[model samples]
Target chain A: MQFGPHLLLAILEGLVTASILSLTAMGLSLVFGVMRVVNVAHGEAYMLGAVLAWWVTGLIAGHPAAGFVIAAIAAPLIMGALAVASDRLVLKRLNYDPDRTIVATIGLLYIAQQTTLMSFGPDARPVEPPFNQRIALPWLERTEEGWAWFYPWGLSITSYKLFVIAAAALILVAIWLIITRTRAGLLMRATQQDSETAQAFGIPVGTVYSVVFGIGAALAALGAVLVVPIQQAHYLMGGEPLLLSFIVVIIGGLGSLPGTVIAALLIGLSDGIISVFFSPTLAKIIATLLVAMVLVFRPRGLLGKAPA
Target chain B: MLEATGLRAAYGPVEVLHDVSLTARAGEITCLLGRNGAGKSSTLKAILGLLPPSRGTVTLDGAALHALPAHEIPKRGIGYVPQGRRLFRELTVAETIEVGLMTRGEGRETRDWVLDLFPRLRERLGQQAGTLSGGEQQMLATARALCLRPKVLLLDEPTEGLQPSMIDLIRDVTVRMRDEGYAILLVEQRMDAILDLADRAVFLETGRSVETVARADLTPQTLHRRLGV
Candidate 1:
């Protein structure tokens, strides 16, 4: 069992990364697809989620699950509200114009980063996972006379990590259902396709834009809350997710939700496996290079159509 | 009365409409005819609040339409089928039509009415609008607008690039809408169609609305000689 346990562990870790990445990247994709704006401040929204998760857990003080559950509810709602405010205060004023909103979001990113740094301090804070029951993984090995199954040393996954994966997947499914099944979802799609015509039909394009922006930020925050336990929450932590999600969006197709999720899976799994075997830096570089190559062949990204 | 008085609008520096005043009364189809760049489209856009007029006012039943935003204009019971029948290409027929009922409480009745109006749409409920033929897209756009249950309807070049058969269908639909008590502002260059359908015709020259003539005073020769088209 030279690398059997290691391989399993890497795969498990990769699944976690993919799940979180999908959530964060889907937000980026949704915002871009609908509003046609690149939100440079997406990472800050994610960071805010993590910090709030930590803060909410601290406030509710009785039990880990109780605190975690409350934090989970509060974080997304708060982030969604903040996102709506941001849209009204900044993006909407800019008229969701592509160039202006990019600059606006970058400014927002700094404001968010600095505000958290000033108030929350520069400390990397941790939140306890709801559960921590470690389940050991079995490995196949050639023992003396015959091949046998045995527990390898350090080859176990925590129940909390599994929970992270499951929670992220569930949230993603909810997002899918919202986009596909709901009347509001249909409105968003119509707005995304043609805002002018959408308006012509009384689908308030402005309101839809604000809600879409809020949902996009809310999704990012949800990912951060789920992952804060595993990855410490820090003011500087948003940069990585922001960068990675942008990469995923670019590779997947700008504004395409399905493309974004698929791209997230590809990037997340590769980032995980590569980080385990080699280096995280190398994984990112490889992901960027792969995206470049994909662009050379399919200019609109994996599933994105050429801009109309 | 969907009325505009002294409407002047522009895109940045270039003015497209100059004092373009016209009225589309209930139970009548008012058509705008001119050559390209004649501010025909601009007139419809100004009425819809898509192009905010720098001068003058638009009123519906003496209520200020110029004060409303583009989306709110539709809620004021004004339905617009823009130039080129700008349907949401990726949206399915059902989704596209449902958009019209966004401001309403329940869409089932309106949806049924839309399906009834355009039976072709009933068959392609799940099909993407982009995949539909041009004529079908025109019908869908009209259906989407009609589903709003608008007091006034705006049609921009509904018969442009359509076959004679499709044109006849659109003309029939326009007449039916007029008969059903919709005040319609139509922008079309098809003189023959306009002559047959319009209750009044306002001809634009360059950027100014030159004159408004009742349908009685309009004919192929008179309309053609005035514009030199």
Candidate 2:
């Protein structure tokens, strides 16, 4: 059997898509793991990041790369602060009640979305690239018989997609290091395992919760900034990624970081490949059905252990 | 080195400790003995700032602790091992001890000292605290508290589910700490063990102090009758 150039491109695109999806879902997973809150507003945070990136680019006169850098850094910091404020003012007061936190975050999602809509309007805005249009991969060339193929530049890939992939990989590695190597990571894991016990160890568990929430929000914001150049920024852009991120989180396992990354990649690649072969509507159905099956077969997720 | 004056606490409307007054002298083990629900744990919670006293004060070396948050309470030269041996389940014994040193602004040296105190912990350092047997977890909990190098230590129901050998180890550790000039306040339902370790004892009933007994006068039968065990 012969795979066409388009099919190969679709596969590469799927990998890129998975990277974006994983970045967003990783944030949601982190919050859920440590704080046990769904953070329904996460998607809205991502949307806000994209809009902010676009806005920053506009302000700087076509400096989209700078916008990306600024938004990537600022979005998380801002969202993290927002998360801390939310935890202190609202979520913390709920006393770690899962149900109440869920409801409150859902309300927060609406507020964040509507606020962005009000500020940015409903227009889909495009972010200009700061870097010059440099083609990293030459166009694919086919043999005269139209049965064999080769790449003129040895690789047929977009520089933008490559940049997104590299950025996402770097972010994931940074997150992994923070969660595993640092004292903050130890406190985070302890708090996630049992908040009371962590507190008993003289850790300010409340502070850990706030910081974790902030970090999670920041990751979501980073994802938004990364995706802006590929997909034009819009107010409603948060909804699609939110659903996909949730599905990825669920399929990966609620509180497991490694599981979340794997699940994100799986879902993103599958969704991309399916959409290429079929319609997006069908792809969504397939992805949802996969999630449901995973839930039924292994409620704890593919790599997650059952909650104690 | 630690004092509680006119301390009162409650869960919702039901008061658990009422105007409880006690003092723990440096280099001595002071035990609070009461039957279940007699506010023994509540006193420990109040001291640790887990449950804020509605009225009165807790002082360590003449500094007020009532206004401090739970996490900050440990920084005031006080360490707490709650009733349930509240070790982080997913963390290893070493990591569990490491968390105790978090607010101390100190480093691994403190953890090394603790590990030396409970040498059993050295062998099981990498094992998850939760996966340990109940007795090992208790050891880990106390060792973790010691990592803070606290001036005073609080233990709540430390011998709740321990075997005889483990209980003896805890008793020896308590006595050693007391002899080393560390102030200790212990809440224990195991009257025999508490009597064996404590220099003095206070009994509580219905959330109020009922009596104080000198350790010299404490016998198994007397404590059994007093505790109604």
- Tell me the spans in candidate 2 whose CA falls farther than 4 Å from its real position: A1-7, A131-149, A152-155
For all predicted structures, in order, the TM-scores are 0.96, 0.92
RMSD (CA, angstroms), candidate 1: 1.8
| TM-score computed on alpha carbons, candidate 1 | 0.96
TM-score of chain A of each: 0.96, 0.92
Top candidate when judged by DockQ against the true structure: 1
- Candidate 1 lDDT for residue B45: 86
CAPRI-style class, candidate 1: medium
lDDT of 1 by residue, B88-150 (tens): 898888877777767544479888987888899999999999999989999998998888888
The DockQ assigned to candidate 2 is 0.58
Candidate 2, chain A: TM-score against the reference: 0.92
Q: Compute DockQ for each candidate against the true complex.
A: 0.72, 0.58
In model 2 chain B, the worst 10-residue window by lDDT is B189-198
- Clashes by residue pair, model 2: A76-A218
